[model samples]
Each structure stands twice: as structure tokens, then as C-alpha cells.
Target: MRLDKFLKVSRIIKRRTLAKEVADQGRILINGDQAKASSNVKIGDTLTIRFGQKLVTARVNDLKETTKKEDASELYEIIKEERIEDSHLL
Candidate 1:
């Protein structure tokens, strides 16, 4: 599955376009490297998404084209979440 679509299908980002934009702007990384919206997603891959002042890390647990809302969380496991201090660049 695509990175952007996976994010949306997994209910992480909520929208595919937003996910694409985020990925394009380098706010999303896979396996510690910046990834594009078209990047392939598979099991066991770690993803880090930066949302404003927060960062969310998750490891892919499974791959699916579609899933129910109740089962969306099964797609990935949250590894860590933390706040990013000092939004203004030096």
C-alpha cells in the first residue's frame, strides 16, 4: 500500500490529500528516511509523522487495502509520541 493511502486507510491522518501533502513536505518518514506519498508500505516498517509540534512514531503491523474503523488501529502499533519544542528555527 502507498504511504499516504495507508495513513488514511489506517485512520492516522484522516485524509489522503492531507497525508500526501504532509509526506511531500517531508513531515513523514519511513525507517528513519524521508518518504514520499507513493512510498511502499509493508509490515514491520517504522513510520514517523510530524504533526505541528508533535511527532508520532508507529510500526506497521499489517497491510490492507481497506479496513473498518473499529479495526483500523490493528494496522500499526504506536511506538512513541513526543512534543517538539521550539517551532521557530534558529
Candidate 2:
């Protein structure tokens, strides 16, 4: 699955376009390497996403073209989450 699609299908980003935009801006990493919107994603791959002050890392647990809301959470397992303080704020 594509990174963007996987994000949406997994209910991580909420929208595919937003996922694409974030990926294009270099805010997403797969297996510790920067990834593009069209990057291929596979089961067990680790994804790190930057959302402003928060960083979330999740491991892909499953892949599906589409999933119900209740099943979305089963797609990825959150490994870690942290809030990063901006240096400019100091």
C-alpha cells in the first residue's frame, strides 16, 4: 500500500490528501528514512509522523484497501509518542 493510503486506511491522518502533503513536506519517515507520499508501505514497517509538537511512531500491523472505523485501529500499533518543544519557544 502507498504511504498516504495506508495512513488514511489506518485512520492515522484522517485524510489521504493531508497525508500526502505531510509526506511531501518531509514530515514523515518510514523505518527512520524520509518517505514520499507515493512510498510503498508494507506490514511491520515502522512509521514516524510529525504533527507540530507531537511525534508519533507506529508499526504497521495490517494492510487493507478500505476498513471500517472499528477495524482501523487494528492496522497499526503505536509504538511511541512524544511532544517536542520548539527551540524558538525557549
Candidate 3:
């Protein structure tokens, strides 16, 4: 599935458009490489997302075209969350 769609479907981001915007700005990485909104996301792939001063890392667990809100968390497993100083964002 698409990165943006996966983010939305998994509830990692509430909106697909916002996810795309974030991905486009180079704030997201897949397997340690910068990824775009249209990037393909497969099972077991690792995603590192930047949200302001925080960075969240998750491992893709499954893929679905659509999922119930309650089941969204099944799509990915959060592996780590860390806060970074502003300068590290560079």
C-alpha cells in the first residue's frame, strides 16, 4: 500500500493529505531512506516519522485496504519513540 494511505489506515496520521504533506517535506523515512507519499509500504518495513520534537519508529505488521478504527493498531507495531533536540532535526 501507499505510504500515505498506510499512515491514514493505520491511524498513525489522521489525514492522508497531511501525511502526504509530511512525507513530501522529507520528514519520513522508510528503512532509513527518505520516502515520499507514494512510496510502497510492505510488511516488516520500518518507518521513522518525525513529529516536531519527537520521532516515532514503527514496524509494519500488516496491510489492508481499510480497517476498523479499533483494529488499526494491528497494522503496525511501534518500536521506539524518542525526543530530539531541535538541532537534530537538521
Candidate 4:
């Protein structure tokens, strides 16, 4: 599955277009390297998304064409989520 699609299907970004835009802007990464929206997503892959001063990291657990809202949780497992405070940088 494509990274953008995976993000939407997994309910990460909420929309495919937003996911794509985020990826194109280099706000998304895979395995610690920058990744494009069209990048292939497979099980066991690690994804990190930058949201403002925060970062969300997750591991791909499974891939599916379609899934119910209840089943969406099976798509990926959140490994870590941290909010970076700008004050810490000062």
C-alpha cells in the first residue's frame, strides 16, 4: 500500500490528500529517512510523522484495502508520541 493511503486507511491523517501533502512537504519519514507519499508501505515498516512541534512514530502492523472503524486499530501500532516544546530549545 502507498504511504498516503496507509495513513488514511489507518486513520492517522484522516484524509489521503492531507497525507499526500504532508508527505510531499517532507513532514513524513520512513525508517528514519524522508519518504514520499507514493512510497511503498509494508508490514514491519516504521513511520514517523511531524506535526508542528510534535512527532508521532508508529510501526506498520498490517495492510488492507479497506477496514471498518473498529478494525482500523489493527493497521498500525504507535511506538512513541512526543510533543517538543520550543522552550526546551532555548
Predict model 4's lDDT versus the native.
0.90
Best by TM-score: 3
- Give all candidates' CA lDDT scores: 0.92, 0.92, 0.96, 0.90
- TM-score-better candidate, 1 vs 4: 1
Estimate TM-scores for all models: 0.94, 0.94, 0.96, 0.91
Q: Write the per-residue lDDT of candidate 2 for residues 1-90, one digit (tens) a residue.
A: 999999999989999999999999899999999999999999999999999888899999999999999999999999999898972321
Runs in model 2 deviating more than 4 A are 87-90
Candidate 1 on 31-53: residue-level lDDT in tens?
A: 98889999999899999988899
Quote the RMSD, in angstroms, for model 1.
2.0
CA lDDT, candidate 4, residue 21 = 98
| Per-residue lDDT of model 4, residues 6-81, tens digit only | 9999999899999999999898889988899999998999998888898889999999998998999899999999
lDDT tens digits, residue span 25-58, model 3: 9999999999999999999999999999899999
Candidate that scores best on lDDT: 3
- State each model's C-alpha RMSD to the native: 2.0, 2.7, 1.0, 2.8
Q: Which ten residues in a row have the lowest lDDT in candidate 4?
A: 81-90
Better of 3 and 4 by lDDT: 3
